[model samples]
Structures are given as structure tokens and as C-alpha cells.
Target: SSAITKSTKIVLNLESLGSLPADEAGPLARYASTIQAQRHDYNGKVLSIRTEDLKSLAIIYDMSPDELTTRLIEWGVLSPGADGSIYTDED
Candidate 1:
């Protein structure tokens, strides 16, 4: 329950944004596409996750928040954030 709550918190961090361009494929894009393809119901449409989303995904995927964040960073899914949220480097 607590874990799920924490995870939900992370999931909620996700930001619902427009889809990336077809040729703009990257690790983060791929990951986002995969999550979208899974058909997870998110307000009746696919949604994107943000840094806050990491915690929930980690709990659901049985990964540590730090570990998930590290993997995302390694895979270029998440870029270093000077502030509280991660910024996707579209370059």
C-alpha cells in the first residue's frame, strides 16, 4: 500500500505531452512509446512520465528509484535537471 502510494507519486510526476516526431527516436522516446503501447489507461490516453514518475515505475517494476533513475540517465531517457524535474534534451 505504502509502496504503491509511493509509486503512484512517481507515476503522477509524469507529464502528458505531445508525441515525439517519427524520426526523433531516442532511448527516452522508445521507452515512452513502449509505455504507451502497453495500453496502460491514463485518463483515457497515453501519458508521459517525468522525474516524479520514476518512483512509481520503480516500485511497479521492482526497481529502486535511484537505480531506475540511473538506468534512465544511462539510456538517455532522462537528462540531468538543474531543478527538481528532469529535462529531456531534444538534441
Candidate 2:
């Protein structure tokens, strides 16, 4: 049931991406770029990151981690870790 629910939610979110304006796209693009860089740094693997690590990542991307995390969670780029931290599931 949870899997189905998650899948449906993802579908809806994906649909929303199609209507985003160019101005709103900038932050999303930047977050995506950072995600890609992190993935590459881990050799195409997903790196488990703590909140502090995420803050540093935000700095690396010239954005605030709080804002970046908000966007990433909305975009499904990062998920909540077991410890309630955020991490990517790229690998």
C-alpha cells in the first residue's frame, strides 16, 4: 500500500514538473546539478548525508541548505534517512 501510494505521489509530482516556469526552473536546475555532482563524487553512488553535510553542500552550490532541502524534498531528489537526516538514493 505504501509503495503504491509513493508511486502515485511520484507520478503526480512528475506531472507538475512539466508546468514549471523558467524562473522557477533555476533553483531546481541548480539543485539537480548539485545532486549530480555529489553522485559523481561518490562514483555514481548515493552518498548518505547528514544535515550538516547537506548544509555544506548547499554552500557548495551557493544556496541555503534549508531552501535547497525544501526544494529537493519536493522534487524527490532527497529522501529522509532512517535517522531523519536527508540522503540521496542515486546508487
Candidate 3:
């Protein structure tokens, strides 16, 4: 038998946030502050935050994490990773 576990972190690209129009990133940055997400900046400028933190963010938008992910994708803020993970903060 194999154990299936969900990922505990959400990886985002810091540069993507920077590329967002102020009108868009402004509110997101504000809401993000509320979550007080613990950020881990990597060499690639990726920001990895706890999944729970993203869930908290989703709740603020009245959405599930999956829905939020879809929305992010629509906004060009997230994309599907090579491994089939729909988790990336990039255009």
C-alpha cells in the first residue's frame, strides 16, 4: 500500500507578483499581509508558503483552494508546473 499525502507548501514566483499591475497586486499584497504567511525565498526567487496559509487566503476570497488556483491561473498569476502541478506564480 502507498500513502498519499497532500503537498504542504505553495510555491510562487516573486517576479510574477512584481509584474502584476499595481491595481491587481495591490489588493493581493494587502490580503497576503493579513495571512502573515511565512515566506521562504529561494535562489530562483520563488516564494514557498504553507498550504494552510494559501487556504487562509482562499477563505478571504470566499473560495476553495482549487477555485482560487483556477482564478490565479486566469489572472496569469499561476501556471501548471512540468510535473502536472497547477502551482506556480508566473505568467
Residue 68 of model 1, lDDT score:
64
Colliding pairs, model 2 = none
| lDDT value, residue 76 of candidate 1 | 49
Clashes of each: 5, 0, 0
Models sorted by TM-score, best on top? 3, 1, 2
Could you tell me the lDDT of residue 24 within candidate 1? 33
Which segments of candidate 3 are over 4 A away from where they belong?
Answer: 1-5, 31-44, 82-84, 89-91
- Winner on lDDT (2 vs 3): 3
CA lDDT of every candidate: 0.47, 0.46, 0.59
TM-score of 2: 0.36
- The prediction achieving the highest TM-score against the true structure is 3
Measured by C-alpha RMSD in angstroms, how accurate is candidate 1?
8.4
lDDT of 1 by residue, 1-91 (tens): 1222232322212232233333432434455656666766444232446555566567665678776665555544455455434455443
Worst 10 residues of 2 by lDDT: 3-12
lDDT of each residue in 14-55, candidate 2, tens digit only: 223334674755554455446557667523223333445555
lDDT over C-alpha atoms for residue 58 of model 1: 70
